[model samples]
Target: MGYVPITPFRRTAEAVCVQRARVQSAPAPLPVVSKWDILSELTEARAAFGLSDRDISVLRALVSFHPGTDLGADPAKLVVFPSNASICTRLNGMPDSTMRRHLAALVASGLITRRDSPNGKRYMRRSRGTATAFGFDLSPLPRRFAEIAEAAEAQRSLQEEIAALRETLSLMRRDLLGLLESLPEECQDAALTLSEDTRRLLRRKAGLPELRQREAELSMALTHVPPAEVISTEEMSTNAAEYEQHYQSLKKESSDSEDDPSWYPMQSDIPGSENALAKKKAEAIPPRIALRTVMSACPSLNDYAEGPIRSWSDLVRTAEGLRPMMGICRASWEETKRHMGQIEAAIVMAAMLERFEEIKSPGAYMRGLSQKAARNGFSAMPMVLALLRREGTAQYSPGRAA
Candidate 1:
């Protein structure tokens, strides 16, 4: 009788061989399955176990060596004995040294086990017309199929959650930017700092917990912002009366005669002349709040400005430049000018610019405001005062005289 030679083994390799033997001898029922199904599950679960692309590629080459596509057709025949040359050919001509390293990785990962022959050569032994493979055993793959599928599902869920977080972060960034532009200087600076922090987190591709924390911080900051207050009709009437009284007092101080030809122009001097009255109204309307202040209140207007609006004239020119762009025809713009006068028209344009996101159609909105002005129902004073309130400016002084 001839004695069978025992193959020498390292401790880890021996342990893996023992485990594969145990799995192979188990009485558990084997179901019909395909090699591609096992490979697909392994690929999806690879990220969870920190497996590299090269490791997966090597596994793919090993899977291709099975005689048939079905993995469960014969559990005992799950072993493959492909040579290094064959594996390299299947792996797009991988070098022998690199193939050995990846093969070792597959063994270490417990996905496959080496079933070496006595002489360390990979081959099948035939006895009584039955062949037994002696090389890489793929039995562990079927044993771990359920676990791999679960891990793959878990990884997919995590990726979906990350995608949702990223989308929410993008919207939060846009809202924060718009809010910062509208906020008072002190508040804007604080919000700007928060925005920068958010941007940094986004750039780094921070995890869900860190991104959610930053989003909560930003939402909390937004909650602390005071809501803008609308100016009432009664307040406007009172302000108009006070302004008229102040104008009268200033006129009295400057001249004793109310009928002075040079001091006050008579209505008869320019009877039924809307342009003269419009000019007088424009001159009396007071310089609007500073260009810097107005731009802060209506940052969208800056996009239309050809240069920095250092003065009210620059703002007017920018508004004029935007008039055609906003689809406000010349006739409509002239009508707005006729009703509201130049200064008030510019101020209305600035206010419209501030609410650009809310108003879908700029031209239509301007036309609506123009109609209100024609009916004596619209006043730039309230809009300006509301903006001043938003800026947290307590004193509502008119702009400097031109």
Candidate 2:
């Protein structure tokens, strides 16, 4: 071999060695993961973070199953964290670079913790690296979410039950009203008797029909008058003729009388002397006054129609004063009728409630009791049915006999 350029070769080898040493001492390049790659892995946590699908799915699963811990692994592992066995298993198929990139992503996401192992002897110990398990801490959030969802569903169901109960109660009220309307008019007295349960259900405003009838009868009694039977026309004619004959005889006797010497008429030459005498007697007592006096004296007149006026003068004055009073009385009567109607309706409602309360009997009663219990609360239905067994009507039902 030729010995030429030996110094130059030594110098070039030395320079190559320095360059290699510099490169070896320099920090390694950081791994890069594309947004598209992250988008492929999605999970609830990552979606909340607005991370891509692939990123969140991979990240959340990693945290849930391979959670971070307070400290990294022991120095024996020679890494910041002892890699999760499950993660390692899942990532085993991936290239080393990709696996390293995933770990960096987990670290950046705060899913893993890096620390020095407790057994470290030196402050700058290269083997002091450790990481936390991110999976354990975040694992229960999903379960909590599920529990909240289930509770909301239960609330919705309860709301539905309450709505159904309201509808049933409304229907029951309507049915009770119809029954009251169709009830026998003679049974009104029976229907008015109320139980405590019935009172609670039918408040005071429900008006009924019986009160209206009584009001009608009262109005008629106050305002009506029985008509008097008049005599036949033949008897009135006979009385009129007899009075005329007696009057003519008396006039003739007065004119014919001339026995006494001083019986001369002062107006004997006047043609209307007898007529003038008759007119004077009629003027002394007016027919209008006499008829009014008789009508006032009669006790058969309708007091409600007549009021307290006795004389014609008093009647006219009192009528003016009583117009408003009569109006007030009529209004009061109407108000009383309205209130009484309300009371009747309330009583009917009470009756229905009492009937419903009588559900503790055997056979038909027991069947009804079960149906009512079921309508109220199905969960308590079976227990109520059992307690109210079909031993007898007394045992199963609580109210009047059907």
TM-score of each candidate?
0.53, 0.19
lDDT of 2 at 6: 13
> Which candidate leads the pack in TM-score?
1
Clashes of each: 0, 28
Model 2, CA-based lDDT? 0.31
Candidate 1 lDDT over 160-242, as tens digits, reads 77766665655665455444434565676566556556655655546778867977887876765457632344654465343
Candidate maximizing lDDT: 1
**Residue-wise lDDT of candidate 2 within 1-402, one digit each (tens)?**
011111111123355434433332233432222222222322323523334444444444454332233112221221223345545565445454655466555434433323322342112233335422211222122213433345445645544554443333333322222232233444322322211122223222222333233334333332322233222346434432332332334443333322333322235314467644443443243221122222222222224234654444443343334324322222322222122222221221122122333322212222222233235511211121111111111221222111
Worst 10 residues of 2 by lDDT: 1-10
